[model samples]
Target: MKKVALIASVAMVFSLSLNAWTLGKLGDFKFEKVNDNVYVMHGPVMMPNKENGGFMNNPALIESKNGLIVIDPGGNYNVGKNVLAEVEKVSKKPVIAIFNTHKHGDHWFANKNFQEKYPNVKIYALAYMIEQAKDNAAETWYGILGSLTGNLEGTKPFAFPNSSVDHKETVVVDGQTFIMRHPAAGHTDTDILIEHVNSKTLFLGDNLMKNRFGAFDESSSIFGNIQILENVIAKKDGYKDYKLYVPGHGPSGKLHETLDPFLNYMKIIIAGAQKAYKNGMESYEIKEEVYNNLKDYHKWDDIEGQMGKHLMKAYSEVEMRDF
Candidate 1:
């Protein structure tokens, strides 16, 4: 009886230690390889809240010759630790690089953990994003996620990306090549679409969302978002053929299902906004009519709540272009 009790205690301790870094509410998630040497862990579609532990971004991993590369680790420190743990399951090699898609806290706050784990790892983001992080972006995100999750206690704004990348720059690390594309401001002025040249996969950050309505913040441009999507689809600006598309907040799939839906949504919003603006209709008055047309997006996360805000931004873009 004594021996059995001791063994049971040891097993319990092992389990507790194993999960010491576990923080997310979404249970049992692992990076699923979507393409050769490319893996993505699609996070919950819902907005960050106390239940989800501030994890609502699709963190990805890329296996290279010497080490792995991470994209958008997660929203906070605990979540970053969990992301690192998942990376270890696939490769014991140190993370050689990280690419933050934009300046959103949900996408890059976890950068803190990666830097602590791999001191030499180089984190990359758009120059604009790096600038924002250096400014008040980090502190602003810390407070935002802290309030949203209520559990982001240990996370801080300490580890902003150390390196800056630019549009159309080819970055080579660990025998892998990534082409950064930022034809225009989309999700935010800081947005960058990372194309893994080897795996033929494109990581469309918050610029493209699947089954979710992303925000059009002050820095965001709906017209610009549409132009980026159309350019990629038409293979313009060297965005040639790709096998897979990974969105910022949803599943990875081919262009038809992964990229087109959101593109179509933005198009509908802009067209409606243009027509409404010409008629001199108020944003609130036009959103309901537009919402009725967005029947297909009715099931998308937060569409109803985000509809008014999206329309206002769309109207502004139309107003800017016409007058």
Candidate 2:
């Protein structure tokens, strides 16, 4: 009886351990090999009701001949650690580079973790993002959320990138050419797009979300975001053969299917906001009117609250004279 009990206990412990390492959910991080050398590891999406639903989505991992390049390491250390472990499972080489598509915590908060693990790894980000991370107020606010969400590990004010690229730059990694382009400022001061030349894969961070939740609060200009979407639509026409397109918030896409709906929504909101601004409507009034108009637009129920919050921010920024 003692032997049976001991074996049973050991089995139970082993099972628990295995379950912990398994992927969490659809929004949780998962790994996929989109091409021969490129791999994408998507993080989980925390919803509003969930404790940390707004924390981190999935990150994308790209393997090149040079080494490994990870984009937006998620919001916490554990997410970064899990993604690193997944990469190691596939390749024995160290992660050579890390990229931040923007300055948002969910996208770039895990930089310190990756840097600590891979000391020689090169960190790449836009110049504006490096500056934005220095905002004490923003850092403190996000720090509180990170702590609440249990994502505060390695969450200190991060060091800026040793290498910065703006506008358009190209680097050859593992024989594959990656073109990093800052088409225009939309989601934030800087929104970057990474394109793998050979494979025709594009990694669009928060600038493009698969879900309609459409968080534009962090954006400096909602009109600028609309222009960015137009640019992407124009680019999509040229890359009809593109295989994979990864977003910051949801699953990947093949064509620019996700871009159209988002652009249309932005146009509608901007038109309404323009009328309100012309009519000398206060910021709050404009926000309310726009929210009511878009309240029932498509599947608004899924992300109305989050979208409303962003719309208010955008209305204030876009309509405010100083902004």
The predictions' CA RMSDs to the true structure, in order, are 4.2, 5.7
Could you say which candidate leads in TM-score?
A: 1
TM-score of each: 0.92, 0.79
Tens digits of per-residue lDDT, candidate 1, 31-96, equal 888899999988888878887888888999999988999999999888888888878877898899
- lDDT of all predictions, in order shown? 0.86, 0.66
Which 10 residues in a row give candidate 1 its minimum summed lDDT?
19-28
Candidate 1's displacement at residue 238, Å, is 1.2
Question: For candidate 2, lDDT tens digit of each residue in 1-323?
Answer: 99999999999767645644344353334467876567776544434223543344657777766577787776655556666666776677778888888776767667777788877778888877667666542485466555556556556656345567776788765676777778556777777788778778777777676554545644557777777667666764233345777777766766567566566677767766666667877545666667666644546434655655655565565566545
**After aligning candidate 1 to the native by TM-score, how far in Å is the CA of 201 from where it should be?**
0.6
Clashing pairs for model 2 are: 27-44, 28-44, 42-58, 43-57, 43-58, 46-53, 47-53, 65-174, 66-174
